[model samples]
Target: MGLLDLKAPSQAGTMTEATGQSSALDPGTPQWSVFGQLTSPVTHPWAIVGETILLPLIAVSLGLWLNPDDPLWVHASFPWAWFAPVVLALRYGPLTGIGGAAMLLLVWLALNLVHPAEFPKLFFLGGLILVMVIGEFSSLWLARARRAEAIQRYLDQRLEFLTHQYYLLRLSHDRLEQDLISRPMAMRDALGAMRNHIATEQMDSDSAGASALLRLLAQYCQLEVAALHYLVDERLQTTAIATLGNTSPLQADDPLIEHAMQTGHLCHIAQSLNQSEQSSRYLIAAPLNNLDGECFGLLLVEQMPFFSLQDETLQTINLLLGYYADSLSMHALAAQIRRKEPDCPPEFAFELQRLWHIRQSSQVSSVVVALEIQSRPGMPDVAQQIQRQKRALDENWLIQDVDRSILATLMPLSGQSAAEGYLSRLEMWAHQKSGQTLAELGIFGHILPLDTDPPLALLQRLNEIAHASAQTRPLRPHA
Candidate 1:
């Protein structure tokens, strides 16, 4: 992920000048140095040893042949002879340098022994050795300096790229926040205005909530298509809400809707190969849950290619859809409650039971259970036990309050037998896995047959039972 690694080969050409400077400082080959084409292939060690020995030998032999009568020929050739050993040490490192230096010394000693009169004096030979040593050390230092410079340049480039990336991320985050926060506020205000217009009982169905929701979603998300669909008998059925530019209706059994209902999350499809076909575009759906945390409908969206649909975007859509779902549920429950019991206060449980059709079936009873755990005095650890219990239960069934007390959930489809089984499993899990004593944790539940009463009455009864059960627990100080 480094900038240099990401750069295209064509773009890399622009960096040639900088690279050449780096190479010049480098101890290795120069940037513009072209390797000589070999007439014959050379082996590695032979190449190193031969190049070191042969170049100097050639220079000395040529010098001697050209100036056969000159006594100073050998001394004049000495400096040129040192060139091969210096190059060998630079290319192959210190050990090879020492080996090449040893070869030159042996040659020097043999020549002196054979023709002592023609050789330079001992003091001069000592001076020449000192010069060769200095040259070898200087080459090593140059190599190290070049490597350090290359590393520094690499770090500098990385820092620059990261700084640019950071600013881009910040701007993107700020824009996303505005879209998520401000759009919802504006929609809520518009809905409030509409509510005022429909305040009179006679104007109930005049304003379209679903249509307004679709419009707000499309405008905020900049979507190519957006719609709201109600789930009818586990099927995705189109409501009076749609904003597709030219797209067809989504299939009844689309996998996207199933995923949303199953996970209670927003699901998305990013691309498709076919344009003329149905479901050929990116799709996102957020499940709409009522106050009881039951999914009632879904908010669907499809967007153009210009926008990048990220996870945060999906979550924002879900939050806005949840708000709309809550509003619609409140209005529907109020209407249903008034029709059932004109004198009663607004009841959530009763409305839910009616909406879920729990009363007409004999197979099961709908139940909601609330459980509270109080740690014993001087208990070793209670917070850990609470966490264990929370994780053990189904995420949909657990409701966390600011206080440590927890609400255990059961759905409309559950019967008395099934609810009891669930509670038993939960109690066993807490005691066995979390080591929570039964007495320390107070457990209670309320069961209502779906067919027996209106939804509001059922909710009231459940609330009353929950309160009564909490009061029975031994009062203790909060942790």
Candidate 2:
């Protein structure tokens, strides 16, 4: 998560380098120099032991060389030999500083054997107290430093992710500007047309709309030579069902195709295959995958103008292919759901299925709120007010009857909390508009999660509840 692991920004000389905290500093790696190792908290235990044993010994030897009569430096203006233990405590911690002081004690014992001098208890005791105090300060700062480093690492990763997203956004904006000048229709329009085409045409098999998908890719991607192949028995077929231009035979073992299949994402020439492998003959290969990670087909672009083979262009192709795959899957799912519940609106069923797939793939949640309003003199007007206040992304299916009105609103990418918030808002708004709360008006709500139950079952339950509401009588005037 450090700056060292991040990809370099497009522009050079970032603030990380300006402050001299270069990205080359890897905290995990061992430092080479003894001082360097001591400065870092990641030093090895053996290294610490060696330094602890040697530092005091070196100081004693220097003291002996300077004044053999008082090698402990007790009589000197300053106790020079005690400085070693103090430094060790500042670098490591209290325990290490205590270890260094113990080594000095051992040295004093060994010297006493030779000279029979009195043990300097005051010298050793004072040194121990100072080392302990300094070690405590060191420990406090070390903890704060580690916490700061962790925070900095997290910030670095978030900044890197945002930088990459910004770069992609800029590229997409450029692509949009170019498309506005060159293309006659918007990308959303093209996707809508493709969706409509798939919905209207018969999709008896997996390869039902392969030709239309190829034509759409050709028109948008300017693919000079490309082919789309269907998947059979969990494998991509060797034969191309639809080709844009004069295309060669499909290579089932192509590296790009194999990578796309393995990763279930688009793989292009720019991506690094293994270092041992050579360049692939195709420019790009992408799997036509739905939101649930199901691959129905593969797209291979053999040739395109050099100028058009950009990150933005490849992203556009990937998006279009994914959209097509999802459309096919949605059409099939919607048909199955509609077959089970005839009264469910086509738009409501299709969106519910799509949201279910999204939940399975991305873990995003969606909620369905079913409101049953008993038929009364003023209830129809309340339903109209609620319908007008629907969120932009919400899809509603209103079923009106002589005895009751059922309004089912599908809130996409929302959970139970969002559903509760929405109901609360509706309650307040309805009270303000109708001068009475929803409960007083005989309006009840049931929250159904798209993920908790299958789409068909959720729709069926909503309908069953509506039917039950029809048999009930309206609320009388409140006492």
Candidate 3:
């Protein structure tokens, strides 16, 4: 269509109506305000000042128009006309107040220009100066109040952030106390007593280990029904070595028992769990492994009166099972180490020697972190994972307890910051695993600095923690 061509008349109204609708909805448009003349977005510094000048001018015009015969003095000194100047000065500072006052003065002068002698210049100017002074005082206080409000909002946000951080820290500390301080003491005592009982006489057979484990669980955990079963004949058959209560069908090579044995995770079957199902006649079956995480036995228990699988109770049970597993693994590894006298891996031995020399020559600090991965597949996989995730300075090692379940890393000079870096990486790795890898897998670690102890003592400490709980060992310093 030609540039000047117009739509039909009916179409012209539609276009105009459409334009009006769009203009109304457009966010860029400013609304009119009688008080301000125009209300602009906050980005404009002069919008509010415009209100100050316009409102007073309009008031004076109205007052003059309404009473044409009123005295010139009364018209110029209209009380309502002062409202704009006073408010502008209080909110927009003194320059705006002065502008508003000048605008009002011009209104008076314009109306009585023909009679200068009758004009009340001194009276009007004096009153305006006093009003401006009062506005300045009010403005000073308003500025301070606004600044104070901003600061209060900033502080409130900071306080809220700190409160959230503190709450998370408290939860972490409480978990540590429960795992390290309280439960470990009881666990150590029970395991020690079991060791003494078994060591009192010769008990090398699978039957003897089972009896002792049952005893430990009974005495410490107060379990009335449980059994320990191990595989024999090249892992081809299942054998029940001990029993606390009447043997349930779980004593056989049920797939559930085998599943727990293989994964080293705990299984509780009401007929199985978390429906809130499986009911009251459920069973709790946990796998017992040696240091290498080879499922050596299945620990089966028909549900008992006191046996609710809460976190605390489950943790205690796992700790006991772990301690039991570690004891057997420790004995076997000690025998193997004594018989073969294997030195630390060449790389590990070199790192330890270098650190020891540095400690002697200068103020050097080194630490050993033993991470026991639960139901972790094999040393090669664990080694590969650590190798990929480890820091440049970190010297990772897999101390395969004879059964091959525990993994420990010897860090030459890891301080608190370095240690946390490794841990956060490990935490990330744990979270990535889903189906089988995540089934019962857990990573537990402990750190011992060489600041006080020699390299040898630190190694021994790492070995000690290597066999503790494979899921809850704390990375606190050791003496």
Candidate 4:
């Protein structure tokens, strides 16, 4: 009735070719193929409503032209006018199918006034039942399809993240291969040192670790002279926050710097430029950016060894700067939580902040589970025992006193249900290993899901609850 082929009656007649590809049609089949496009259900509201209205009207009009006396064909061998509603029911489901049926009822009533025919109750009743049956089945299958699409999208994101990480790994390996013999320090060692410096230092301003960061870059990048400048209100500040190896003041209008600013990526002398760089002093310009594409600072290379200026060296600079920017951002966000809980591990705080960002942007969730363990007479520390069971992606922070310990585990990309399942598993493990339940072993569990509250705030609240419980309980004298 809708002009599409009836050969695939099971398939819906809704979307065009583009929608088919987005909805994940078979990879082997071309999107333009009739089977691919027409089979997919229409998700847009206007399209569904339009088709639901138009198809039944077409059927009714055709019926009127063929037989004015019994346009619905109720008295004929077959009630052909009911075809549109049944097809629609199979396509979109019950609500749309029921709408088509209601239209036919209105038409039937109008015909009764003109020709004075009987009610024909059985005809309409049978069509409604058929439509309802087909629509119910369609609804169930459509829900499954939508759920599958969501899962596919999440997997795609994970794959993309892994691919980027793989490229970073390859780049690091290439750098190591090129510099291992000449350079005394490895990239990983330098990175670890930088992370330790960031963890220990107080980030009072945007240029918190500027000097140390520049020194690290100088060591790795073989820079004879360079300067790092922080951005203020989207404009580069003239004064250099950190300078290495006798660098002059930054030139704000340098061609390389302007190019880097315009493109939001690393720019060097070798790159094509519209402006003449004959007067420019800097050899390379790089923006310190995080994964979110926020540029907080700029690195200008005033001088470097001629032979050292290569693709590998430039990529190393870009990668290190990006990593530093991301780390700095995390430290800034985690600083508040760190102040609230001084004993909290910096790694845990940093990860919590990162996960909070991911949750906000992608709606994927992560949870923090706190397990309080009281030292028992015979058994080993339950907190440390649980720490050994940390999952691959989980980060654990264990705080220990003489007689008590609190183990806070951050399960990345997990939800409330996942936390519950983890707790249940831990409870079973405790029973099996210690021959007693969690209660018997003096271990208490609390699940704090990262939700409406900020992650830093949530972690601070967890510390408060833990401290309150510690203060109220009576302490046993140390032996």
Candidate 5:
């Protein structure tokens, strides 16, 4: 038989459909039969040779024991010996079968010469030739079946791996769509709804604003806890102003909070909570920075089941929290500005002059001197002047507008000579401006004591001196 004889039959039409149904019912049936046949061949070279060699040897020994004096009985008993070559051919394949047959023929001829038997030598030779053809065909068919089975198994494994990879790709695509598109849009809509409540006229105070923000963040982000902490600076002693979460307010030592505060970046802790024991889960902290890029506070949020605190999510949270901080800070600053009820007070003016005189007389290690730019011809716009001054003194001093005519600034932790040098730079800047001369403008300044007074009080004193100086010196024309 050729290699085709070994292959499992491919069913046709209705039979194929039936086979598919049967395979579904019994998955391993085909594989079991294929492997079984490969291991146990019906008739092979080894099997035939082994049996032929053992059978004759046993018969001769039995005959010798039964009749020691019967010479004719021994010669006749070996009549079945001619069949040994045929048996070898049936059990083994063509090459091994032919070799076994040749060996048996030589033995039979030698025995016939020694004690001539009645069997024909041609009969044994003809039987061996027939067995060779049959054995060769059977062995060829078995080898072909093994090859087909191996090929089928290899193809099946490849198909399975491809199917698994396809499903995984689909799952990844769905996750990306949900995370990038859906989640962000949902967050925006939620923020808009919260903004409606915040814009209402009745809502006031930082605490109320913080509470509103926390509620919206929790709802949108699916967080279990959300808290806002305000920075409280009490003469360099910083503390938390308000907390809205169930957990204890975060101390200065908390790593997540400290990192957020220091870097003004978002920080997160994964697997920080125990669900069964009711511990805080994942924590995400975003820093709230001012327009000056100074961190004012932190917004701490915690999630259950540990929601992914990815960079994009953290950035969105930071942006929204920053807006809340800006709005609240603006409201507080406006209120504080309104409470200070003075354009220029006499006592403040006298105190400012006294401080300036003391700094000029004393030889202290460090004194902060500041110049008050009362009037300028080109920039009559106060807002524009403030902006320009801010840009100019971005890193130099702490500047603030006291009133319409005066701008007060502090050169913190500096001395009288340094203050004088700062004043000279201000004079040069004033002279450089178009339509303005240094001598033409009334610019009075003062150096105040860094201790024993608040920055706000010092600012108030400077304002008074600036206003008095402006009144004393008449307005100069553009030069």
Candidate 6:
């Protein structure tokens, strides 16, 4: 509220040397004073009041003890009792020092006026005023220094916090790159490279994604040959197979493949777990499951390193293959729907039909939120997070440009305010919750009503927003 209260900070410093701001300044405490525990600045109100009142009382008590017959300063042996007030003024601020000195001056005046003047009143009063002035200067400087230190501590803590967030964000992006793409890179530049890959590789056709996934395995997993199997009519059948590095492509399903398909869990040819005399070549098969937990396909690998057969590696392969299968399933389903309808996509046709009815109703409204990601890669995790947080009535679309970075969500029966609120939440998740700052991301078209805005026009506006979001944006990261 005031300069005096500047001693306190809104929050404590982070876990660093410049930790955080102090709520209050206490001169007696460490780091509170300019010198090591030198000046104890007056903080507590009652402590200063006591010191001011107690000094004057002690002076009066000493005078009365010296002369019981007349308990007045004039009857005492000493004329000047100024040491107590001076010391109090030096330790406390101007208020306490001046108040105590004024009491002593009253005693001095009574003694000199009643009896005789032994000491010059002008000289005595001048000395008291000087001490008060000196004490005030000392206290003022001490307060300023403490306030500065507290502010500095707060800034340092903020810097530390931001540094940690950036480091972790960078690390996650790097790990994502290493896992998603088989290219090794410097830790610092991993995210940028991954972003580039995502911008190019994202929203690829099911065939393209599967092909890339197999290529990745060939490079990183050190597989000589890989095959894909699909579950058709309750039986596993080979769909596609890839070979690399002079390895022969296996057309027939081996016992290893059949066994892996029989059991849903990943199966691998290993010397430690099984001692059967088989070919020295290594083989592994992992099942790709859908949301319903039904096996959709099989991912086969041959001649992989035994060391890479651990649970972590198997899990990673399974997840990647599963994601690839999901893309395949979605694209295949979309094609089927389009062929049957021939007029419009099944979902789009249904939405338009529903919009026709909702248009007549005066109560219902619908809007769209178009988010354009400018910095981070549009990974599956980000989409999954949006899906988890989205409402049942909303339609989430993965619309890709040359630089696949934007996601558009349409509200079928929702107002403008609801759409904007959801946009704010998405911004918060990107910046605060997901550790990806909105500074690099941008929002366009606060809300667009679906009933009023044409579908093609809305898409064009969203595309315009995506282009504009990256051009003019903030780079600041918030906690």
Model 5 reaches what TM-score against the true structure? Answer: 0.33
TM-score of every candidate relative to the true structure: 0.31, 0.50, 0.31, 0.60, 0.33, 0.36
Clashing pairs in 4: none
Q: Identify the leading candidate in terms of TM-score.
A: 4
TM-score for candidate 2, please give it. Answer: 0.50
RMSD of each: 25.8, 13.5, 28.8, 11.8, 35.8, 23.8
Candidate 2, residues 1-479: lDDT per residue as tens digits?
22123222111233222211223353533347988654665477898898889889999999889989887798778888989988888889899899999998888888788668777788888989999999999988876676555445434533443443344355456657877777766555555666666766665554446677777677667788899888878977788877888999887887777777866666677653432266788878887776445788888999988777654465666566766776777677788776777666656778788678666654566899888787787444767778887886688999877787889999977889988888889888877877888777878888888886878788777877777643463322211
lDDT of 2 at 27: 55
Better TM-score candidate (3, 4): 4
Candidate 2 residue spans exceeding 4 A from truth: 1-177, 180-182, 198-209, 270-281, 328-335, 342-367, 372-395, 398-405, 410-421, 433-457, 464-479
The stretch of ten residues in a row with the least summed lDDT in candidate 3 is 15-24
What is candidate 4's lDDT per residue for 183-284, written digit by digit as tens?
Answer: 767767777777666666875444547777787778777888988888889999898877888878677877778778876767677552324535567878
lDDT of each: 0.49, 0.72, 0.55, 0.73, 0.47, 0.53
The parts of candidate 5 lying over 4 Å away from their true place are 1-206, 212-269, 273-308, 311-378, 382-404, 449-457, 466-479
lDDT tens digits by residue: candidate 1, 1-479: 22113222112332222122122344344344345443322448778677767755665566567755442244454455555556655555555555555666666676567556544566346545654675578566755665455444434433433443343344345655776665545544554543333222322344366656665556555667666677668666664344546555665456665555666655566322121233523366667764345676776665544444654344345544655555655456466555654433322333343435523432223554444443345533543443454322122223333333334343444456765565566667657964764454543333354446655665455444434444474432111
Candidate with better lDDT, 4 vs 6? 4
Worst 10 residues of 1 by lDDT: 1-10
**Model 6 / residue 30 / CA error / Å:** 60
| lDDT string, candidate 6, 224-324, tens digits | 66666556777765445333444444444465555555555456665213534444333676676632246766776766665665544544454455444
Report the number of the highest-lDDT candidate: 4
Off by over 4 Å in 6: 1-208, 238-241, 245-253, 271-282, 294-296, 333-367, 370-417, 420-479
After superposition, candidate 4 runs with Cα above 4 Å error? 1-186, 200-208, 272-279, 350-365, 376-385, 428-442, 452-457, 468-479
